[model samples]
Target: MTIDPEASPPRPPGRPRSREADEAILGAALDLLIERGMGATSIEQIARRAGVTRATVYRRFPNLTDLLVRAIEWEYQNTQPEALSWPDVPAMIRDWAGQLSVPRSRRLIRRLYGTVDDLPELLRAYDTAHGSHRGRAVRSTLEQARTTGQLPPHTDPETLQLILSGAALQHLAAYPDTTEPKDIEAYFLAVLRQVGFPAASPSPSRRSTQR
Candidate 1:
């Protein structure tokens, strides 16, 4: 799953927020989170890695949890393409599976899921901060897919989204150590079959040629 970079609204009418500092802090936090698990990554470490004062981080985010959540979401804004299009969906799916199979993404995702143990409340707060960015995009994509007959007329995007996301988490968790590409692709096909994906399912090579 991805977080929205624009999760935080404009700093109220009071003081100006430093955009440069915001970017630096979030970048540092994300790097640290990937390298170190949530339990080990600290606010002070983030501050030090970011080359900013602890006060700077606190000013941008209330605490370590907020800092971590925002950093995850911020990557969505900065790293993602301007648009998530249908033409890119197949490739995006492949890339997502690849990411899930990798070390960094696996660690970050597991860490987020594990937050329930000690920071369930903080995770809930992050859900509120998530806003409508990714949800809206997913909805729009499903609607377009439906319109194009890429999904069955009777398909429910919301339910499908939840199932796919949940299954993806399960997939990552099941292969906590390593996930083979073949395994991920098999999982991908299973998910598509369940969703009744209307397109002709192609082998990776065939898909590349088709694209």
Candidate 2:
């Protein structure tokens, strides 16, 4: 398991906060982080964009690093697998392809990955927070499939998860002609075909469940 930096330095307990303000601040922070990155994003900028007082932003987060960490997490959550339970392998592949095919998602992925070397803390913050949610879920689903004899005896869940996600991320980051959802969907299906995507057993647990 990876260290969870986001869980450390826990949030302080206080009076109930205004939900709208929280959303506004987070929204503004995410926009700034994506548009300019950690170096350029600041509390003042977020405050101005969110139309909230600096004090309000401070009340929520003590520092810019914390704020950026949370904003990165917000972006990460938006892209994670939506299925809380098991999802169909083919369908999830297509869904991920569709997501990565979009211009917004492409830019977000490029920005995040482009910053990985320069800003290790950005990744540390995100990885510690929610980077592995999709991997975990996919692993669980693969394990279930293997255990049920739906997948080949040689099927490796971890590697499969890496290959699936890695391909999607690479395609999103590297490909320019994949802006169409169908293009992405087609690409993922090709990957699946190469891997011989196992047919799901006629079982309830194998059915896709979208969140």
Candidate 3:
């Protein structure tokens, strides 16, 4: 028997839904994931936390993995890095590190890393999206440094790009519970100094503080 198209059940009506609902749902999902971690979160819990029906959540996201991947993308878009200054690399690194160290963001990231083996496809997508932006930013910053003479004329931007990216990730993983922002700032500044950036100016109380 042929199915009648018009006889199919009608889509439930609402005022034309807001595109913002998608953003809201993603944001809520990320928040819940951060609060509860991966193992504890569920589709039903996310729907409840997002204040939408489970069907609505599924309509937007095919599964928990899809929801998580989209939520990570949404968070990345919301926190796009600002323009960088060549002379301010230390401060920029510190700021980026601080953003990553935030409790919720850190928790989500930790959970994502933990599940890489089980959800390689989702992890690949997450890595591609995040790595693209990070790589672009690293290249831009290094290029600007070369143009402005902050870095040596012969310094390889590509090499510096890898170095800076690896250093940032390593530091974040090593000091997940960073308490002093200044300490983080100092660590990056030390890297720059080793790479030939001039040492930062001494604080006015440097002599007293040292004693």
Error of 3 at 107 (Å): 2.8
Against the unseen true structure, what C-alpha lDDT does each candidate score? 0.70, 0.72, 0.69
Taking all chains together, each candidate's TM-score versus the true structure is 0.62, 0.71, 0.70
Lowest-scoring 10 consecutive residues by lDDT in candidate 2?
Answer: 202-211
Predicted structure with the largest lDDT when compared to the true one: 2
lDDT of 3 by residue, 1-211 (tens): 9653423453567646557668778878888777776778888898777777677777777899889888877766644455333345555676666656566655666667767787665566666667566677767777677666677676777887777767766765787564466766777777776776642445779967987
Scored by lDDT, model 3 comes in at 0.69
Evaluate residue 132 in candidate 2 and report its C-alpha lDDT on the 0 to 100 scale: 67
Model 2: per-residue lDDT, tens digit, 121-158? 67776776565675687788777776766666678889
Report the candidate with higher TM-score, 2 versus 3.
2
Count of clashes, each model = 0, 0, 0
